[model samples]
Target: MTMKTSFAFALAGLALVVLALAPLVLPDYWTGVLLGMTGYVTLATAWALFSGPTRYVSLATVAFFGVGAYTVAVLNEVMPYPLVLLCAAGIGMTMALLVGLSTLRLAGVYFVIFTFGLAELVRQTVSWWEVNVTYTMGRYVFLPFEGRHIYWQLLVLAAVTLLISWAIGRSRIGLALKALGDDETVAAHAGVDVTRIKLLLFVISATIITLVGAIQAPRWTYIEPSIVFNPTVSFMTLIMALLGGAMRLWGPLVGAVPLFLLFEWLSVSFPDHFSIILGLLFILIVFVMPNGVLAKFDDLRKGNRA
Candidate 1:
């Protein structure tokens, strides 16, 4: 194998070992934090896989995530957990394919607005269905699983997401994605098959995001449209990807750790002012590291080499 591939395999093994041992030794609170952060990391990583290379700026994380959550809520008791995840993936991929075909042609602000609007549409539709058809506010999903098991499950999912992302980053498809992002018309003229690649990446991203949502569903005792469809998840996913360095493989994981910690701190210590504090921090990150902190570091390393 190539040195790069070998290094990647070594890192994956190391991460697996760490994740496996973490829940056993850490306190319950820390294990829970690991679980939550891993979920967000998976979301950010999945988003970066598509949005970073293609610059699509999707706001549909909440929509796909909520779909998976609601799927679990509706099917948790009817099927095994593994089967429920497969169902969630299928539904998410179907939604992504339809959405991608419709909106992938649009560019810039129109695309962003469409995605954001789609999230709102899904949220509203779920709310309406809950009130009218289901006649309920939320559903209770009883997971007969332990906290450690959940943590390990999330860790495995995150690992798989990262591996796929890394493979894409190194392959020819990644080159095509970058070219398409730079200039879709030119890339298409050069026979890059822009439409097919973007749609494939979108479906892959949606599948991973939905799977994370499905796996995390039972973490909450009650699942509601309002909770699962919250815009905060969408916003954070984008922010984490940008903050960590969207172009790099490790950016989302690096960004998710500190940001998640800060979010938890502000939410607990200054709940009323959490938004204000987080907003200010986000502004600082954007202003200081527009291409992401990882990109800045990469630039510095390149300069040093020169």
Candidate 2:
């Protein structure tokens, strides 16, 4: 097998081995941390699939995520849990369709800003629903769930997200998206249907995120604007993708693990300055190693010329 293929297998094997042994080896607290980290890794990977390949960074990546979480959160009051998940995916796709069509008309930074604003608008609308819930509002939304159910559901969500990302990376649409990313004008001229391709990716990516959000809702058993619309999601996803090396399919995992460990440490040891330090590290990464920490593994392995 080729060296890259070997490396991929080795990495996968190593990850599997660690995961298999971890529960038996680690403490309960640490297990929880790892589980949460796994969820974050899944999110990073999902964002990377669209942004990395397309080079069209969508800052509103969490919009669909929020849509999914809220759909289940509100619906769980009436619908079954499984149906909530399906509805979450549907909500994400619907949001993607609307946002993609509206913002796809814009170019470059404009598209990013438009989507960001669109996400903000969605957040505000959700907030408005609270008024209806309390008194002026006509409806109320609440979700009742246990913590463990959410945790195991997240595991399944992560697996599904990973599988979809892998399939997309190897699929015809993925190739088209990659091409459109490399040269939009040329791809469009070539009859590649650039808008449709991006829209499809938007929907698929959103669907995955929504599934994750649905899983999240049960654990938190609550949903709110700031958390759902947090800019941190964009930043964290960016950091993970950058660390893992955007071009490589496995880069998000490579990036998120170390960063997340550091986050856990800082949060535990120096809670006060954690955010500042994390922010600085991101700047440092951008200024020093723009390609990402993990994507450069191959470079580090190269020897001097004879």
Candidate 3:
């Protein structure tokens, strides 16, 4: 293998080794932080599959995530875990289908606005549904509290997410997606079905994300509207992608962990001042490392070698 390829494998190996030991070595609080960060990995990796390669910015991650969470909650309430997973995946794909049909016709900011609106609608719907469910089922509306199993479940989610990312990064579709992302007109002239590619990616990414949400609900042992539909999840995913340099194999991992840890530490250390500090940090990171921290480091290293 080439040096770059060998380096990538070694890095991946080192990450896995650390991750395997994390459960046994880290404190429960740190493990929970890691688990929380894994949630962003699920969303970021899913978002990247289309956005990173196809240049489709989807802010509807919260919407898709909410749909998946609700699907899992509803199905698990009535059916079984495995069936709930399938149902959630279907719901996610169905939402993606509807979104692609309606908005892929538009370009640029219009497309983003439409998806954002769709996500907002999902948030409102979840909020309304939570109240309705509470009224309908009274005390039994939510799941009972569970323990550390949630982290284990989230580990599975991280694995599944990484697998999808790897597969898409190696596929012919990945190349086509990159072409479309770079220039749709050129992609179309080259005989690529730009619309079909976008639609297919939307569905696939949504389905994968839905599976994560499905597993997440039961792990949390509860579901609420705000938690399920929060745009914080979407924001964190975006930040993860940007931090990792969007298109790179392990950007999300590098970006998500540090920022997530920072968030937790800031929140604990400064409490009231944490939000403003984090806000400043976000701006600083983006301004200083527009291509992402990894990209900047890569350039610097190459420059030194030169």
Candidate 4:
């Protein structure tokens, strides 16, 4: 590797080491906060993996995330934890494949609206099944995982996601995705398999999101369609990714940390108005920093150099 590449790897390794050791030293509350932060970091980064270069703006994140959580809730009692996770991944992959095949052809706002609707459809379907067939509204997850365990798992997953995103960003597929985002017609004319590429990335991103939900299920202890399939998850993932400038590999992480903390504070301090504040923040970010905070920073740097 070149010097710059080597330095980046070294820095990433060091950061991972530090994060890995954090739960061991931190208090319970802080560890929980870190766990929440790590979860969003993974979600936002994975969301960006497909939406960033492709500009798909998916709101189906909660659909797969809820699937994973429910998968674990349904099977955790009978299967080993690792096997439950594997099953969740399989189910998530299948769902993503089906959704991607059906919807990848639709672009722009249609795709966005469909994805948002997908999460609601899944949530409502699950709700109906529970009420009509299962005679229950929720399932309990009784895994032996503590907050620290979940934190470590999320940290590892976040690191893996970052590595995968970085790898993809350096690959030929990345170039095709950027081109596809710029103009789908031109990209297809240039011989890029637009449909296949979009489907592949969407599946990968959705699967990771599923795994995140599965791993986080134990933290909730009790899972229901409404709780696990919250639409806020989708909106927050999008906002965080966009705020960080999803086009860059590390942009989601940059946006997730501070926003997650701010969100936590808002929920605690202004529980009644948290949703209103979140909506306002979303509007502000879209209007003032449409390209994201990182993009704005880049513009400033370029201007200074000029």
Candidate 5:
């Protein structure tokens, strides 16, 4: 490996070590917060894996995440936790494959709208099933495990996501995706196999996202369609990726950690205005630093030198 790749792997290893040890040292509240943050960070990174390189602004995260959560919620009673988790991942991959094949060809605003609408479609379908067939508002899940167990699981998953993203960013496939993002027609003309790569990345990304939802579902004890399929979840994932620099492997982590903390603070201190504050911040970022906070900093340094 080259120096940069080696350094990135080292950094990822160090981060994993720290995350693994964090719950041991943290208080209950802090551990819970970290668990949530790690989950979002993982989701954001998974999102960046496909969307960043492809420049596809997908809002389908909620669909996959909700599918994972619901799959576990429904199957946990009949199967072991590990089995449920695996099944959830499979279901998520299937959903991604179907959705990506059908909608990946749509470009620009149409693609975004289709994804957003797909999430709502799934949410409504689940809601209808719950009310008409199950006659329940939500499913009850038994979580006999401690908080730290979930925390460790999430930490490991997040670490793996970081590693995978870093590897992809440096691989030949990464080049194709980057090229695809620049111009899909050119990438295809250059023999990049655009369709296959897009679908594969979509499935891979969905699998990781579902794994997170399945692993974390037990911590919630109860999950409703509306709760799991909330648009805010997808929105936050997108925001984190954008704010940190979606093209960079570390972007999701950089975005998720601080933004999650800020969200927690706002929810606690000014619950009524939390959304407003977050929305304004998002708008400000879009207008002033569309390339991301880190990019903006680099630009400022370059200007200073000039």
Candidate 6:
């Protein structure tokens, strides 16, 4: 409606068009890099959708992600690819619903610890099932999709996620979430249906994350619990979301791109020290830009205007 809003939407649309055509023009190596970047963009954005508003700080990203990948690995042989994705979403939503109902009541560090533990629990469970029942440590994924296809799918997912996040930010539920973030007691007193709001957003976030994992599974070709359900995925997503200013719709995108590039470089240049550097970066972000780069920038802009 407003000129600024119309201009922003136009710019976003142009960026999306350019990104969608990226695979055709980009070299193989760069395309691969872009694919990975897009994966994180989707993950971080989805993570922020729930965590940013409610300030829940969930670490269960990999649980749902691994479930999605594993779902594809197990059922791709028997079911259609689209059906497998749907199943992954369904499983993710169910898991999130159960977990949210039980743990959303817990706040601060307790919620954080439980979510981290939940990912580990899912990983261990999958590992046990493979070892005892399947008699295999990992499953191979055989699909017709290539890196470009996966990249496109992730790109689309990321776009949809951004759109959904933006839409939610403009809705009544978004206000409820923000109020919940500020003070759960006050929000409930104000008739916000706190539990329902948190659970709904959490499930939506988890389902998107699951779909991301399913879309990306074929790229791995071989997925084990450890590989698919790596804890680093959870941490990286959290760091990115926080770094970008999780409270803002486009904050995760800002954080994910730069941090993903930094991680890529660190992984290659200092493979042994990569984890240490990641930990250090996380500490630095928490101390230096706890409200995220976007918030910091906004603060400076306001100060200048004043």
Best by TM-score: 4
TM-score of each: 0.95, 0.85, 0.85, 0.97, 0.95, 0.97
Preferred candidate (lDDT higher): 3 or 4: 4
Deviating ranges (above 4 Å) for candidate 4: 304-306
Error of 3 at 165 (Å): 1.9
lDDT of 1: 0.88
Candidate 2 residue 253 Cα shift, in angstroms, is 0.8
For residues 1-306, write the lDDT of model 1, one tens digit per residue: 899889979987997898889988999999988898998999999999999988888988999999998999989999988899899999999999999998887775677888888878988988898899979888998889777888888899899999899889779998898888788899999999888998999999999999888888888879998889888899888889999988889999899989998888778899899778877887888888888978888878889532
Provide the lDDT at 82 for model 2: 78
lDDT of each: 0.88, 0.73, 0.74, 0.93, 0.87, 0.92
Encode model 3's per-residue lDDT on 1-306: one tens digit a residue.
689978987887687667756868778877777677777776777777777776667777778877777777666668766676777887788878988887886786787888778777987766676567655321122444343466667677777778777877778887887788788999999999988888887888877777667666765456666677777667677777788777876787778877787777788999989657866777887888777878888889889622
**Model 5 residue pairs with clashes:** none
Top candidate (lDDT): 4
On residues 117-153, what C-alpha lDDT tens digit does candidate 5 reach at each position? 9889999998999899988889988868778899899
Question: Model 6 — TM-score against the truth?
Answer: 0.97
Which TM-score value belongs to model 3?
0.85
**Collision pairs in model 6:** none
Give model 3 RMSD, 1 decimal: 3.3
Off by over 4 Å in 1: 304-306
What TM-score does candidate 5 reach? 0.95
RMSD of each: 1.9, 3.7, 3.3, 1.4, 1.7, 1.6
Quickly count the clashes in candidate 5: 0
Write down the worst ten-residue block by lDDT for model 5. Answer: 297-306
Prediction 3 global C-alpha lDDT: 0.74
Clashes in model 2: which pairs? 132-137, 244-251
If both were scored by lDDT, which would come out higher, candidate 2 or candidate 4? Answer: 4
Candidate 6's residue-wise lDDT over 143-166, tens digit each? 999789999999999999999999
